[model samples]
Target: MDLRFRDPQTRIGNLADEPILVVCPRCSRRATVTPERLTCAGCALVRVRSAPNYSVWNGPVDPFFREPLWLRADCCGGHTLWAFHERHLDLLERFIAAKLRERGLGDDPGLTLVARLPAWITAAKHRDEVLRTIAKLRATLS
Candidate 1:
C-alpha cells in the first residue's frame, strides 16, 4: 500500500478510546489499562485509580497507571518501540509506512503525537527496522 500521511495533528489522548496494553504488576502478563483501571485476565488482577490524573504520554507505559506497556520491542540499536494501543499503533504504522510524510504542525506542536515522536523513528535509514518492530508489536496483540 502506498500510504501518505499529512500529519493530522492527532494528539495522544485522541486514541484513548482504545485500551492501552500494560504489563500486569502481579503476574507480569499482558493486561488492559485505561484512565480508571488496569485489568489482568491472566491473574484476575484489577486496580482502579482514585483520581484519574494523567497527561499525554509517548513512551512504553500507560498514562494513568504508569505501568510498563505490554506492546514494546527492542529496535534501532538501544531504542525501544512502543504504542499506547491498537489505534496508536495504527497511526504509527501509517506514518512510518508512508513514503511521503508531510509535517503539518498545528498551533501547539507539542500536542501533535506524530510531531513528538522520537527522531530515530522518522529517520529514513531506520524505516525498515521500525516497520519490523511495528509488526512484532502487532503480533503481541493476540
Candidate 2:
C-alpha cells in the first residue's frame, strides 16, 4: 500500500523536522535561528516564527536547509557595531586595531591611541562615526 501523499499547499507536520529557512525581509540573505526564533544573518534581528517545536530546531544548521533571514546588507553592520558592546570590549578593541592596521594607519600614534580606548567608549558612540574617523585618519596618512 503506497501511503505517500503529496500536497503542494499542505505543509505536513512530519516535514517540520526539516530546518526552517528564514530569509531576511530586507536583504533576502539567509540566517540561522533557534527553532522558535528566527535570526537574520544579515541584520541580526530576531523574530518568532509561527510554528511549533520552536526550541528543538533552534541552533546552527546546514545553511541550505536553514531558513533565510531576509535582511539588508546594511543590517549586517550591526554585527560590526555590536562588537564593541560592553560585554565584548576587549575583542572589539582587538578588531579595531586589526582594522586600523589593515588601512595602513597602524603606525599612526593618534590611531593607535584611539584604538586603545575602552570598548565601552566605542560602543557608546555610533559605528558610522568611528568608520568615518578611521577613513579620515587614513586619508591624512596618505
Candidate 3:
C-alpha cells in the first residue's frame, strides 16, 4: 500500500489560530515555532524540511485540526519534540491555572500532559474544540 503525508503548513487553515511549540529533549530547549524554520538554541541545529516533518496521523482528520500533536525528531544530541497547537498550549495552561486559582486548588506550574491526556480533557477526543466551546460559554455567561 502506498502511503503519503500532507504538508504540515498546508493543513493549518490559519496561522493566527495555531501556534507551534518546539522542544528539544537532548538539551531541554523549547521555543515557539517559526514560520520560516526551527533552530534549536541549545545545540544550534536547524530544521531543514520546508514543511514541518510531522508523523502521519493515525486518524481521519488532519492533525492540524486535532488536539496538539507532539512530533519528536532527531536534533542536537537527541530529539526535538514539536507540539503543533490547534488551541495553543499557553492558553490551555492559563485556563487550567485560572480555574485552579478560582477553586483554590493551587496552581500546577509547568503542568505536563503526556499519554492518556486525551481522555481527561473535555470532550475527550476533541480537546481543543471542546475547550474553545467551554471558553465561549464562559465568555457568554460572564
Candidate 4:
C-alpha cells in the first residue's frame, strides 16, 4: 500500500527548479539564481537560498504549469529589488533622477523620494516613458 505520509524529498511530482535572473546588489551586475544558490557573474559571489518564501507556486502542476513561478532573490545585502522581466526598474530610476533634478534635490540622500504608484501609472507621459525605457532595456538584453 502507498503510504499517505511519505517522505517529501523521496516523493516525486513536478518539482520546480527554475532560475531567475537578477541584478547583484554589491556589484550591480546581472546574475541568476536557483533554489540552491545565487551566482553572480560580475562579483563572483554565491549564496544559498535559505528563505522559504523564495520559491512560490501558483497552483497544481498540470493546471498551472504554463505560468512561471516567481523567484525572489535575496542573496545580496538584503532584499534586493531585482527580478526577471523588470526592465521598468531602470526607467523608474531615471524618472526619479529627473524629478530630483527638477526639484533641485541635488545629491541629498537625506530627503526621501516618495511617489504615488497610482498617479505615476495613470499619467500618460510617465507611462510612455516607462514603456519606452522597458523596450530599450529589452533590446539591450536581446
Candidate 5:
C-alpha cells in the first residue's frame, strides 16, 4: 500500500493530552503521567503536579513533571529518540513511514508538528534508521 498523508495539523501540545509514559524515578519502571498526576504501577507512587505551568517541551522528557520519558532509544548517530506515549509514538511512526507527506492546509503550516519536525527526522537519507529507532521505542511498551 502506498504511504500517503495529508497533514493533520497536529501540534505537539495536543499530543500531551494523551498519557505520557515516563520512567519511574522511584522504581525504574514505567509510569503514567498526565497534566494533573503521575502514577507508577510498579512503585505504587502517585504524585500531583505542583506547578501546572509548563514551557514547551520538545525532548525526551515529560512536560509537566520534567521526568525522563520511558520510551526512548538511541538512533541517528547517537541522537536519543523518544515519545510521550503510544499515541505520540504512533503519530511519529505514521509520519516517518509516509512516502508522500504534505504540509498542512491551515492558516500557518509552520504551527503543525510535522512542519516543526527536526531535519534529521524528516530527511530521506535517515528514513530507514529513524524507522528502526521508532520500532525500538515502540517495543518498550510491550
Candidate 6:
C-alpha cells in the first residue's frame, strides 16, 4: 500500500469544525486526530489560534524544562495553521522510548537526552534534530 495515500495532505482550515486524522511529523504515529486545533497526542504541545491566517504552537518540549519552543506556520487562509511544540520533553522522550522499545529498537540515550531540552536549545545544539526527526518519520511512513 502506498503510505502517501494514508497521509493525505489536509487543508489546515478543516480542523476547526471537527477532529481530523493526521500523521504526526515528529513521531511516526497514525490515526492522530485533531479534535479542535492541532494537538499531538504523542506530545504535550498545544497549537493555539492566532490571527486569521496564523497560529502558534508554543510549549515546553519536556516536563523537565520550563522554556517553551514556538513554531509558526502559514495557514494559507484555511482558518488553521501548522506548527510543532517540543514542550514536555521528558514526556516526549518517554513516549518515544516506549515506542522504540516496543519495536525492539535500542534507545539512543544521546537522542533522548537531547529530546529532554527545550526546543530552542535543542535546535541550537543540534540544528537539525527536529527537522530531521520529522523528515525521518515522514519517510518511514510514506
Error of 1 at 102 (Å): 2.0
Q: 16-45, model 1: which lDDT tens digit per residue? A: 777888889999998998778899999999
- Tens digits of per-residue lDDT, candidate 5, 6-51, equal 7888888998877889999899999999989989999899999886
Q: Who is ahead in lDDT, 1 or 4? A: 1
**Residue 103 deviation, candidate 6, in Å?**
40
Decoy 4 TM-score against native: 0.36
lDDT score for residue 80 of model 5: 82
Runs of candidate 4 with Cα error greater than 4 angstroms are: 1-18, 51-83, 86-119
TM-score of 3: 0.31
**Stretches of model 3 off by over 4 angstroms after superposition:** 1-19, 50-87, 93-119, 123-142
- Candidate 5's displacement at residue 6, Å, is 1.3
Which structure among the candidates has the greatest TM-score? 5
lDDT at residue 26 of model 1 (Cα atoms): 98
Give me the overall lDDT of model 3.
Answer: 0.36
lDDT of 4 at 67: 23
**Most lDDT-accurate candidate:** 5
lDDT of 3 at 102: 24
- lDDT (Cα, tens digit) per residue for candidate 3, span 1-142: 1122212222223433444544543454543344444455678766544655463443312232232223332222232223244343333334333322222222431232321123344233444444454444334222
Residue 103 CA displacement from its true place in model 5, Å: 0.9
Superposed model 5: Cα runs more than 4 Å off: none
**lDDT (Cα, tens digit) per residue for candidate 2, span 1-142:** 1222111221122233434444555566655444466667677777775645333322223223344222112212433222111222223334443323322223443433234444543553544555444444333222
- TM-score-based ranking, best first? 5, 1, 4, 3, 2, 6
Model 6 has a clash total of 11
Q: Report each candidate's C-alpha RMSD, comma-separated, in the order given.
A: 1.9, 21.5, 16.6, 19.0, 1.3, 16.8
Structure candidate 4, residue pairs in collision:
none
lDDT of 4 at 47: 72
